[model samples]
Target: MSRFQSKTLCRVGILAAMYVPLALFVGIQFGNVRLSFGSLPVVVGALLYGPLEAALVALVGELLKQLLTYGLTATTVLYLIPPMLRGLVIGAGAVWMWRRGKRLENCRTRCFAVCILAAVCTTIGNTLVNWLDSVLYGYYTFAYVFGDAVYRFGVGMLNAVVVATVAIPLVVLLRRQRVVQEVKRP
Candidate 1:
């Protein structure tokens, strides 16, 4: 691997390590809804590095966490969807905006846009997945699932707010600190 890739992977590894405890312990869960701080690292990695870094952190990290904590199960696969979507969508969106000159360093609106896009994508993807899992398991009727969807939607809004609030400043801070380096597009 090239030096840049190597550095990114190392950073991803570190982010993955940070993600587990924050996800399991720092996150808040109410019934089927969960607000996870774990995604913060993924978003940070994505905005700083790129989608690959974010995906590695989200996918590999969460996989390891699931394997270690709950072991293998059919349901374990379902857990991967949300984080992966968050990382990919957020990373790609931010990177796209940056490459298009909607730079995060000066534009708070662009930063907010990235956060909102990520949150919307994550919320929709996870909510669908949750609904599917319930249907597949015969856990609830369509009416009940609709009720659950409403609850999940509320939780998703909360999650979006938290992610945007935390990520934008952290991104700016990382840039100011020189901890986040912008990747050059070829």
Candidate 2:
């Protein structure tokens, strides 16, 4: 592989490793809080690597968390699909926004745009997944899931906002320090 490809692979591996534990902790803590910061890695991976990498990271992380928690349940596996899809959506949206910002010559604006896009995408994705789960389990009607979806979406948006705000600055700092650049080029 070229130096760039190797470095990119290494970064993705490290980030994927980091995401498992972080996501597990966040998933365990998820309750009344509609969203959690676990999705940040997905967003970052997507922005840096692309949508496929981000989704793979998300899928692996979710599977790892499931294994650690209960060794896998049918319900868990079923629930996992939506979040994976959500991660893809968030990643794709972030990448798009990032590219758009670059084209516009407004890095900060792009970051903000990606943040908002990630939040909304995640919120909508989570709500739909939760609704699907509810339907499959026969616990609630689509309408009820729709209501819960609203709540989950709100929570997801809040989490996205928080993660984006925190992550963008950290990413900027990392960029300034050349950490990401070094990893990409080395």
Candidate 3:
């Protein structure tokens, strides 16, 4: 029990710290396109721990990034909604998966599905937030919201894929190392 608790705490701290630096420094940029892998840690945390831990991870990381990068703009807090929601969706899906199967023989497939679903939800949430920010700051227009909607979703999907690709093997390794307790019912 102590081991489990300690492991959880360590993992949570690592994930939260990982999120900020990654968000601040790591990104893909090509012309006007940018891709961020900041959600990877959040997704991994949600899958390993649960919703509350996941949300905390997202909050700490994003809040710190906002303070450091943008210095608390009006939309700073609002922009955090998508990553937190992604964590929530993934964490909730994990619970659902837990309920559905004891062995979870198809864990990989299920993980992929959950990641994709979370990405979709995040894309929608992000779009709404962007639109709200634009309206509040006086850049509102149909084109502003809908024009790049598809592109944003594509980026979300790509991010989800990257997260899952990295997370699955990492989680498997953690379980193998007995860092994370995997309780099975017989």
Candidate 4:
């Protein structure tokens, strides 16, 4: 494989590895919601590697965690959507910012904004997934679904906060270490 491909895979592997343990142990799960810093590595992967690689990292990491925690079930497939969306939206946003010449190291405001955007998107995605899961599984009635959506959105926001808290420092560190290189001039 080429150097770039190898490096990207390595990043995905390492981040995925980190995500499983965080989700499994460090996170809290109440009912259908999982709030953890697990996705933080995924977001960091997105920032460094872009959406596809980040999505891969999230998918593998979250799938492994779910497999271990709940075993292989139809729900597992349904559950993957939120994290994948999280990675895709966050990673894509970061890449877009980079492509537009926003140096994360030098532009703290832009970095914070990107992180917030990622968090909001992740929250919305998670809320939607929870809503779909409820409806598809017939787990609740209309009133409950609405309440659950709101609750999940709140939980998702907490998760987003955790993701941003972890991701921002990690990104800054990567930039300092020169692991996150400058975007090429267009």
Candidate 5:
């Protein structure tokens, strides 16, 4: 592989390693609240490397978390798919927006815009996945799932907003550090 490809693979591996423990700790502690810095890695990996890398990181991270913590419950595994999809969709959207001159390099406005976009995209993706899961499991009617969808959307929106506001800035700060830069480049 070329330098870029090697770097990308390394990044994906590192992200998966870092995110698994962190996400599991947060997931176990926070559960549905999900008030952790897990998404930051996905966003940063996406911005620095690429969406595919970010998606890989997100998926592997969640899988590892589930394996370690819950020993792979069917429900948990099923729920993991949505966040994986959400990370992929949000990362792709963020990268696309950045490449199209969104300029989230240092501008606060650009960063906030990117965050908002991520929030919306992830929220929609997550809601859709939950709705599908509800349908598949036959836990609730379409109307009930629809109501739950609204609740999930609202919570997801809040989570995204909080993550964007807090986690993105922290990721940016970490990115500026020499350690993070070396990791990104290597």
Candidate 6:
């Protein structure tokens, strides 16, 4: 592998390793929402790398989370959608900004906006997944799923702001330290 590829994979592996514990243990519970800074590393990956790598981080991290938490139930794969969506969205946004000559480190407002958008998308995807899981496993009523979505959306957005707030400086530091190089998406 090329140096960039190896370095990227190493960073992705480290971030994915960081994600599981963050999601499983470091989260702040907002009732049923379970808000967490787990998204921090994934968003950082997105801003630093690109969509595919960040999505890999989300997928592997969430997959491990499911395996450890629920032991691979029927909804295991379904549950991974939200985090992957978050990664993909932020990554695409980073690419878009890069094309416009605006680095995520330099465009704080735009960076936060993209993060919020990704969070909203993740929240929506998560609600749909919950609805599907409820239907498939009879875990909860369909009505409850819809009702809880509003709360989830609010907490998710808040978590996005927190993740973005933290990720910006973190990415800046990574760039300054040359731990992660700036990526311009094609």
Off by over 4 Å in 2: 1-9, 26-31, 75-78, 85-87, 93-106, 142-144, 182-186
lDDT tens per residue, model 1, 1-186: 899878777888899998898788887889977887878788788777767778889887889888988899777788787778878877787677677776552566666666667777777777676678787887856765666776776677677668767877888888889876667853
lDDT of 3 at 36: 73
- Candidate 3, RMSD to the unseen true structure: 3.2
Cα displacement (Å) at residue 176, model 5 = 3.4
The candidate with the higher TM-score, 1 or 2, is 1
Q: For candidate 5, list the clashing residue pairs, or say none.
A: none
Provide the lDDT at 116 for model 2: 63
Alpha carbon RMSD to native, model 2? 4.1
Residues 1-108, candidate 6: write the lDDT tens digits.
998788778888999999999989997777777878888879988988878889989998999989998897888999899999999999998888888877865799
Ranking by TM-score: 6, 3, 1, 4, 2, 5
Question: What is the Cα-based lDDT of residue 16 in candidate 2?
Answer: 69
- Alpha-carbon deviation at 6 in model 4, angstroms: 2.5
Model 6 alpha-carbon drift over 4 Å, by segment = 1-4
Each prediction's TM-score versus the true structure: 0.84, 0.72, 0.85, 0.81, 0.70, 0.93
- Top candidate by lDDT: 6
The number of residue pairs in model 3 that clash at the backbone is 0
lDDT of 3 by residue, 1-186 (tens): 697677667767889899987877888874344577788788777776666678778887888887887797889889888789888988887767767663221388878888889899988988898899999999999987878788878887887888788888887777679886653322
The parts of candidate 5 lying over 4 Å away from their true place are: 1-3, 27-33, 69-81, 93-102, 178-186
Count clashing pairs, candidate 4: 0
Query: Which should have the higher lDDT, number 4 or number 5?
Result: 4
Best by TM-score: 6
So what's the TM-score on candidate 3? 0.85
**In angstroms, how far off is 132's CA in candidate 4?**
3.9
TM-score result, candidate 4: 0.81
Q: Which stretches of candidate 3 lie over 4 Å from their true place?
A: 1-11, 30-33, 101-106, 181-186
